[model samples]
Target: MSDILKFPKDFYFGSATSATQSEGTFEGDGKGQDIWGKWFELEPEKFYNEVGPYKTTTMYKHYKEDIQLLKQTGHNSFRTSISWARLFPEGHGEVNEKAVAYYRDYFETLRENDIEPFVNLFHFDMPAALQDIGGWENRKVVDYFKEYAKTCFELFGDVVKKWFTFNEPIVHVEMGYLHQYHYPMKVDAALAVKVGYHTALASAYAIKEFKKLKTGGKIGIVLNLSPAYPRSNNEADLKAAEIAEAFQNKSFLDPAIKGEFNPLLIELIKKHDLMPDYDEKDLDVIKENTVDFLGVNYYQPVRVKARDSVPNPDAPFLPTYYFDIYDMPGKKMNPYRGWEIYEKGIYDIALNIKNDYGNIEWMITENGMGVQDEDRFKKDGMIEDDYRIDFYKGHLKWLHKGIQEGSNCVGYQVWTPIDCWSWLNAYKNRYGLIELDLETQERTIKKSGYWFKDLHDNNGFEL
Candidate 1:
């Protein structure tokens, strides 16, 4: 490797994890049940190997040691969400003092170790009490979310200067409402639209609260942006890709950054009679309370082509009605995870933000490869994850190119620092710089972790 690639002096190097995925004290220490816990209880077999959300890496019990591990891995910044149910057990009404103290200490500890905490308000772990009353589908839930966001800011804003309203809010809409991969599984397109609309509105309300508080900190949202690629330049293919882009990327991207929904998406929703019930005043709130920055959690690109057959009118309306997934020949893929590995997608996303979204300040909040049965590659008690290191280098090279071209991108954070429980998938796949032993809760830095430290210390790596 040659020392040719370099990042900006202030570019951050860190990792991200969510509370439900890391913290194991579910329903413990006065914590209430989240959707994940509730879903697991309702259907244990839905999760891989019946590994429910009960016992994760146990960050709640071992955060101090984890912070030391974060330092050893050379993290200057870290992102994690405060569990809403943990903070407010019933979603609203009363505060859980223990959860409050836990988060305060966690943020303070990270700050004391010189790691800037990038805290997010929600990460798909909605309080079951809120979900019991219709979750994001009901407008009332939006107000409850705003209250939760405000509470988080007031409690931990001092130590955590960077705040995010939500992490991949679309995932809840697409996975839970449309695809039935998550809790409250339903396949109603209209309900998906309503849930999505309310989620964006909730984010705006949180931003409104943040601005009102005058916290002197930047507030943003984390979006998992997958650039859409047309299979061909034909009019049909182009149109399909355009619709895919609107639904997959611009739905949340436009609302969070530009403070408006994409017109193409609006037109499509109206055509399908899926317009969400919304108050005009809510639109004004969204228009005014745009994000200060963006956190992009990019992992793959969506390749699209025109649908080969006419849609069945009798079937429930869905975004897939507009296009079909294009499996491009010879495309590189992650053998372990079955997702396409397109490094240039990062460059495409950066340039898209630069040219279209006003070049807003942003960072790669989550990008990492998840491999199955990682222990097979272990050698000398340490997992030699060279593939992960190369994966980072591949994506970073493109990110560097984008930044050099005036993309205004600031940092790159891996999906996680230590292997944690993934929702539904559980620990079937591991994506982390550190190898975690679930039985012993032992944290061991992998080969990629050492490589990341050098990259972080040097602010970049050789090409």
Candidate 2:
């Protein structure tokens, strides 16, 4: 390998953010309440520092200036989601003209600035009205989501060429259903399966709608693919790793790419008596509507090991029943966010997609390091985020190695270009190239922002 890692000339360098996490106008402008807004209303104390969703960077108001900042940061592409509630106030039946106009202008502004807009249909922001009817657990919500997807395509398919049906669908299932972290939090393993199944069905339905329109654009799903690494080469540990991969990665990857589910995962679900009720025809739709490309979000790897003890039948069911997360000593750590930082994991994911998934076209949709109290790193009026710059270089080096070895990965997009509100954590951990002042809505380019600009301009960085 050479000391200089050069990316393909056309490889995209950009960042991503979601509407609910960045857009601040929660109630006005004819926007209906999303689950986040509703959740904040019900339990304001649950949010970080009691700072609710309404206290975002006000992208709904500052998007024009933000676009300039994107240019300043050398972004050729950007990913953001449409607020479902803002579009269809009641999830369906009525269209908000103001919301549509706002989005149209926003996307057009991005195009005018020479920034390509990659718009995602859903980003874990379900309309509160739909949640009232059981959210993703109810099959009816799937059709509603399809209708919303169709509306977005018809409305903005001109300016937006890249579309994603969902962003991290598993998070909705695992966090919202099995883990009790998101809205309508529940711990029902059976319900989690149903939600996961319906979410995939919803993506296929949306892809079906997109294909029917012939928008001349590509549609895909953004999955947070964390490669499962076993603690040892023993058969039991290998089996545990396989199960973890099937549950965490292949659960959606198979259906979205291969147009089928992993048989092992199906057997496990059956053994646990947690199979979701589904129509045979829905499986057909999923089979026929595989994605055009894939967007991978990698932040860490899942370290797995075989269970240490016999199963307890009386315990509530969870995916961890078959294996446990291995706390491998000497592992690289990002203590600020409590996530393991394994840059080589990016290379592993790319190679897995290349060898196992037929070298399908893909990109790193979200990768970044989030730090707490970033202001403490400020020196002479700028946050010297060399840590973030180093983080990006470490991952990109391995990603470049994968590309050189025949991985079909095309681009790299960071988690975000600006500091935005995170769910639950809110602004506790900052992950952005541009620093944001929550109080004044001021934006300042951090040192990483300048470093990223050079990386993007040169199409690569030195190892």
Candidate 3:
């Protein structure tokens, strides 16, 4: 076992959380309303169990204790996003000094505990004021985001060396404009293209600005890359999977890493006549400001097959117009979260990066299984999350294989440190090393948490 599955000594082990999901004070401490806060007020039924951002784990007040818990779980590094509205109340001009002080103290405390902080600028929470003007749709929001990135660098550049421009930028386009899961729920394909373009452009702008600071730190964007697999080797099915990969994965990955759009994706966009308006300058910005590293957040692979019927010409364009998601028979699934558990998907992603794109420095920024009714697993004083342990081991085994094959993978960070409020899922599915009792905000390390500590200490575990 020692000779078979050992991890590199320098390979980082940690977990990740976003500000909106973990920090409870959405409207307090001069934090202007984010889209989540406003959306809850507008439509309370949209969230599960009627839980909102205001009732999260209260990481704002309990960050010190939380960091201690992170250390207890064997996290040598942790990633969290900075709330844009928390820093700039209106999303543009004045800096919220209180929020600044809180983040500074938060980073300092993490550093004091010997845990590195991987700070991200934006998650899904857009400032409501910005959304009013047009969140990622309007080009002006891109400039505002660039300014916000600069402010974070000026303030936290001394301690925070690892920075990410955005977390899952594609979600804003796919969920908001296409699937209608996010705020400003519109199903316009053209509008989705515009939002996606502006998001990739904004990431480049942020990277350019971050480099200008000369902070001697690395910066990149976090992308959720789910490899699209065809249902069969048939030509039609392979074409469907190719289109899915182009739209979902390469749309952001190409621009961030390759500094260009995939030609196949561009061809599809043009064929559908959903091309976004852009100028030479925006193209130049994207081409010139490629990222220094990459962050991958992979959960499951998407299976696709050719559409049974042709799309109506008069109807609005959709990505699924060319293909349909195929549920592979006999696929293993996480019963609670309902996501497929194909561990080899991690190896596929790593090899894709190594062989197709240059093997750039990268890390598993987020990967974990979320379980519903997790209380059922509680045993003794802690939750006996043996399933969660198995989940990690399966993924790690493949990830170790990738590393052995010269994939240049850097670290592994789970989706969360503690069970906190998910976006629309709220508390329905819990994915954390530590369980948080929402009533008392009490945190107790789960059995998986203890097991992870030993893995971190040993640098590997027996399979």
Candidate 4:
């Protein structure tokens, strides 16, 4: 084996997955149907080959076995989300006993194996009941979310010390309300703003409640921050990049970390007459409460430029209304995934947090590569996913650089531990250290998994 790359002794190294993505028992354990479950039943064709959320990595049954794989891969920690519907089937009123039992056992199992469990409260699995009730668009959903979050802390707090209120909150708003990728899909900027606001409010409320309970834990909101890049240094391109950054990254980053919404974002919303309905007290709640930590999901940087023509009909829409995505030429790219390969974006984010945002303790929560079905490369029960290994090496190098440069980063968790469902992409984009065999419930560790094990054993990798 090559000289292993290891992280600091205090730096956490693990993998992550959302409940809806990996746990296949979507309809089991009294789990009410989520939007994804309903979406598959309604129009399965929209998904890649009609594969639904239920046909996933089946982690519910295999978490015990999977924990062994994680240990073998040198994972001292692992991150996963609890299904909201699993915890509270109707999204607000009732807590499912079976889910509570399953999760209690799940955390226990992880701890038993000496794997620190980092649990997230929400991960894009909206209960269908809530969607019918206007989802995040309705302000009442905010209270329901706070209740759910409090319930989770009380239920699982004993075992879980690190809690994330939401994973990629902006992505949920952009996809569910601004874009038509997720279920309950609507293309309404006004609704999107309302949803994003409530998400922040809910996060704040969760933090407030967690503090009251005195869980001796940290609370945070996860954001998929892609440092926006201008197509050219020209004024228009540079301005477009700034706008894109404000719309995507700053929208949540400012609110959750700084406890205030972005002024430019607010003005843009007002300019478009796209302000959300909000009560006065909500702002006070957010201002008083902020996350204990942040989960930074840096997959790729965004390339943007000003739009040539305002999008159709002179009406407001998502960020696409003001800016357009422009692929930068002569930039290195990741072959496995079509996303731009800009490892420096990680350093920039870390520096942004350190210098601008007070450098609250953070982590590289979700960074990994997604390759097309990786099963064909299996050799003697293992996958030779060297590309995935290289992806880890490239990103980890930047992560180490950030840590050395006073970024206050604490941990690194890849996007997933096993192949899991990826929103509309479903199983199309495979990102996992362990290869999951869908047909037979078999799992084989990829080469990256071995590399991670050695890295963990050595406490840092040497290039």
Report, for every candidate in turn, its global Cα lDDT versus the true structure: 0.93, 0.93, 0.92, 0.86
TM-score, every prediction:
0.99, 0.99, 0.98, 0.96
**lDDT score, candidate 2, position 196:** 93
**For model 3, how does the per-residue alpha-carbon lDDT over 33-123 read when each residue is reduced to its tens digit?**
9999999999989989788898798999999999999999998999999999999999999999999999999999999998989999999
Pick out the ten consecutive residues of candidate 1 with the lowest summed lDDT.
Answer: 1-10
Model 4 stretches with alpha carbons more than 4 Å out:
1-6, 26-28, 310-313
Misplaced by over 4 Å in model 1 are: 26-28
Pairs that collide, model 1:
none
Task: Indicate the residue-level lDDT of 164 in model 4.
Answer: 91
Which one wins by lDDT: 2 or 4?
2
CA-only RMSD, every prediction: 0.9, 1.2, 1.1, 1.8
Model 2 regions more than 4 Å off: none
| Local accuracy of candidate 1 as per-residue lDDT tens digits, 18-98 | 999999874559999999999999999999999988789899989999999999998999999999999898999899999
* Two-way TM-score contest, 1 vs 4, winner: 1
Residue range 1-463, candidate 2, lDDT tens digits: 6577899978999999999999887456898889999999999888889888876889999999999999999999999999999999899999999999999999999999888898998998999999999999889999999999999999999889999999999899999978878998888999999999999999999999999999788999999999999999999999999999999999999999999999999999999999988879999999999999999999999999999988799987888999999999999999999999999999999999999998999999999999999989999999999999999999999999999999998899998989999999999999999999987889999999999899889998877
